[model samples]
Target: EDKVVQSPLSLVVHEGDTVTLNCSYEVTNFRSLLWYKQEKKAPTFLFMLTSSGIEKKSGRLSSILDKKELFSILNITATQTGDSAIYLCAVFNSGNTGKLIFGQGTTLQVKP
Candidate 1:
């Protein structure tokens, strides 16, 4: 079975602080790893990593994948109270079947 695990289940930070979240996975025939930010009921897509050594970035948020280590990291800079949310990591299992295995998610709280 494909599995995703995220560390530091929860975090509390003040405004303008930076945070790093970790995610590791173990699966056969891995296709890709995806990151999402959940603020309300729905989760918003953040990044999708399919190759190692390439860093994907959007504003103060960025992520990198390490295929050799079967893990990924998400970095958030200058976090604000608005950045408080749950971050999710999911892995796509590729074996002629479409499946997504998700982690428990990391909840982040930012105080002003």
Candidate 2:
């Protein structure tokens, strides 16, 4: 079965700390990788990476995909208390179903 795994299931850091979150996967007919951040409401789209080695960025958050290694990393620099949330990683297969296989997610707590 296709699966995705995230490391350091949970993390706690003081404000201004930089963090690296990992996501690895094993799937058939890989298509793209996606990252999301969930707060009080819903998961918010962060980045979608299709090409390996290309880093996608938004504000202090950035992510890169390494297809050959079957993994991806999300980096957050100078994090703030507002950055506390659940970070999710998901992948889409090349199949026509358009369904995304998701990992359990990494919960982050940024203290002030």
Candidate 3:
């Protein structure tokens, strides 16, 4: 079975500090690494890294994938109160059937 786990379940930081969220996974026949930000009813897609040499970036957030290590990291620079949200990492399983396996998630709180 494929599984994902994230550390430091919750975090609190000031508006100007940067934060790095970690996600590790164990899976068979990986396909893609995905990141999402959750604040509302549904999560919003942040990045998807498939190619080995490419990194996904959006504004102050960025993520990288390492197929060999079966893990990914998300970095946020100069966070703001509006940036507070739960970060999730999911792996897309590739085989006969497709499925999304997600980590528990990391909650980030940025204060003014």
Candidate 4:
């Protein structure tokens, strides 16, 4: 079965801490790695990393995928209360599009 796992299940930050979120996976034939941020309802897309070390960044958020190691990482700098949300890691299969298979997610709590 293709599955994703994220570490440090939850986090607590005080309005300026830089945080790194880790995600690791095991799949029969990996295709892509995706990141999402959840505040309410469904998660909003963050990054889709297919190459290693090459980070995709926007504002205070950045992410990278390491296909060699079968893992990915997300970094958030200068976190604010607005940044508080759940981070989810997902894998996309070229053959499947039913819905995104989800990890339990890493909940981020940024205190003001």
Candidate 5:
């Protein structure tokens, strides 16, 4: 069975602070590692890492994969209160089943 683990299950930070979140996984026939942010009921896709040594970035957020180590990291810079949310990491197989094995998620609270 595929599994994902996220470190620092929860975090509290003030505006302008930067944070780093981590995810590690063990899976058979791993296809990709995906990052998502959840503010409400739905989760919004942030990045999908299929190749190692590639960093994906969007505005104040960025993520990178280390396939050799079977891990990934997510970074948030100049954090605002709006950045408060639950960040999730998931892994799925290469069989194209559209099934994802999700991590417990990291809850971030950004306060002004």
Candidate 6:
């Protein structure tokens, strides 16, 4: 069975603090892993890591994938109170099913 797990299910931090969120997964015919940030209604796309060791960055957020170890990490630097939200990790398999398996997600709260 395919599964994904995220560590530190919830976190509390002050503004300007840097945080590292972890996601590990096991899936059949792995394709890629994606990260998203959910604040109010919709979850915004953050990063998609495909190749191992190659990091994907967007503004203050960055993520990297490790295909061999079957894990990924998302890093946010100089966080702001507005950054508080639920972060989701999802995996896509190489099957034609076109399904995205998601983790329970990590809730992050940044204090001002």
Lowest lDDT sum, 10 consecutive residues, model 2, at 91-100
Residue pairs in clash, model 6: none
As for TM-score, the candidate ahead, 4 or 5, is 5
Summed backbone clashes in each candidate are: 0, 0, 0, 0, 0, 0
TM-scores, one per candidate: 0.97, 0.97, 0.94, 0.92, 0.95, 0.97
The model with the greater lDDT, 1 or 5, is 1
The C-alpha local distance difference test score for the whole of candidate 6 amounts to 0.94
RMSD of 1: 0.8
Residue pairs in candidate 4 whose N, alpha carbon or C atoms collide under 3 angstroms: none
What global local distance difference test value does model 2 have?
0.95
lDDT digits (tens) for residues 1-112 of candidate 3: 7899986799999999999999898977788889999996699999988876577888999888877777788999999999998998998889777888899999999999
Per-residue error (Å), model 5, residue 74: 0.5
Better of 2 and 3 by lDDT: 2
Best-fitting candidate, measured by lDDT?
1
1-112, model 4: which lDDT tens digit per residue? 7788998899998999999999998875567889999998789988888778898999999998888888899999999999999999998766555345668899999999
Worst 10-residue lDDT window for candidate 3 reads 48-57
Question: After superposition, which runs of candidate 5 have C-alpha atoms over 4 Å from their true positions?
Answer: 95-98
Model 5, range 13-91, lDDT digits (tens) per residue? 9999999999999988888999999998899999999999989999999999999999999999999999999999998
Of 1 and 3, which scores higher on lDDT? Answer: 1
Superior candidate under lDDT, 4 versus 6? 6
lDDT of 3 at 11: 98
Q: Which stretches of candidate 2 lie over 4 Å from their true place?
A: none
> In order, what is each prediction's RMSD in angstroms?
0.8, 0.8, 1.0, 1.5, 1.3, 0.8
Provide the overall lDDT of each model, using Cα atoms, as 2-decimal numbers.
Answer: 0.95, 0.95, 0.89, 0.88, 0.94, 0.94
Worst ten in a row by lDDT for model 1:
92-101
**Could you tell me the lDDT of residue 13 within candidate 5?**
96
